[model samples]
Target: MKPLVILLAAAAAFGADPPAREKLPTSRADLENGEKLYQANCGLCHGTKGDGGRGAVLAGRKLSRAADDAALVKVIEEGVRGTEMPGAWQLSARESRQVAAFVRSLSRVSSKPVPGDPSRGAELYARNHCSACHTIRGLGGSAGPDLSDTGLRRNPAFLRTSLTDPEAELPRSYQLVSIRSNSGSTITGARLSEDSFSIQVGDSSGKVHSFWKHEISELKKERGKSAMPSYKQLSSADLDDLVAYLSSLKEAS
Candidate 1:
């Protein structure tokens, strides 16, 4: 055989490079490097601790767009279309992979599994008339926050806190409002939106009441109050069942 042919045969017998998957470095150092990159590049919008600010919450929440490491790497390298999230142009391929690993580290897998029958919880949810104010998959009233994706956004502990103490953490949108009109009629509801001149409220009856600043005699916006009452009165098993049912709710399901 020719010398060139022998060389070709030898080259074919052994690979020149390792497989692509083998090149991926998963070490403590890599994760630390990724954290530095994430803090420098993404922390401003995603919050220093990844709790969220101008951008969506990253920690302890379900990430629909990039559910896995590979997908996250792609998203970090190439931004999501039609969204404010921009691609990381400054990062190299390795740096992008590092960032994805760091992001995956933020996922909080629940130690205690959801501890009730979802089917029974659904029955209890209906029995409790929860649909009167809150919405579940667009089937309930619009007065309260839509809980179609509650399972995705909130953890089990947070859900439990919300159920036991409804007023513990009040988002600006859900702050309780009491408006007394010129006719002495009082309307209490959760504030939906507000501006300098007008405020929109969704009352207990699922009716939106829009009032101009000049029209209402008194406008009371009380923080740490929710239209939804506490469910501490319910039996422990019932509450657990309800929570389980709620926890089962996801945007996809």
Candidate 2:
């Protein structure tokens, strides 16, 4: 049968509300409704066509978090935990289903080619000693966020922007702090955690230091400042290669 017929069959199967276990089917009405909903609700970050802006690129790639139609629906309603994607709190299950179907269809759209070679990017990552601060595949340091599955989490645009402008969109958890002791000495590092009585910090050398509030004269939490240096000086090709490498760090198939 033709693709159009297949789509219509799926749409008829959906009716009004279908079980999560069922596959997607789009009647003409359903397709138009889904597209309208998606454009209105998801166009800001995901783009009207799901080409992506700040969110993950949804076209022409195997979605690691959403493996099937049911999975996509679940993600739409519940959201991906620990990431910027939020749950469809304003949308009901049926509306969420509509959005999920639209998003899934975006996979058939053509995606822009990823700019550089992954192999070259991998070599660049090691040469630049990126593992000194960032952890990947459980083998690197932890001063920064673990990037073992960065490809699954962030898009290339975000990655490239972060490289050239480290101060932009620092992780919400990022808290580089300066703590001054009663003795007038100071220590600066990433804040691991803080409680009413004490706080933990990871210093530049990756040594975690614990201190009591009583001993600290002042504690200042810095924002919009990343310990990561900007890579603006890198050549365009080098930058592209680096971004490609970072984008390729997906979860195991």
Which candidate number would show the highest TM-score if scored against the true structure? 2
lDDT of 1 by residue, 1-253 (tens): 6999989988886676553451335799998998999999998767666655445557766678876666777788888775568899999999988887787776563224689888999899888787878888778777788878676545555677778888775555678889998888999998888899998888877778898878899998777789877888888888888878887787753
lDDT of 2 by residue, 41-137 (tens): 7787776667665676687777878888888887888888877888888887777877777777888887776799889999988888878778788
Q: Which portions of model 1 show Cα errors greater than 4 Å? A: 1-25, 32-62, 67-99, 105-112
Residue pairs that clash (backbone atoms under 3 angstroms), model 2: 10-25, 10-26, 11-25, 11-26, 11-27
All models, RMSD in angstroms? 9.9, 9.1
Badly placed stretches (over 4 Å) of model 2 are 1-20, 23-25, 47-54
Report the number of the highest-lDDT candidate: 2
Q: Candidate 2 deviates by what RMSD?
A: 9.1
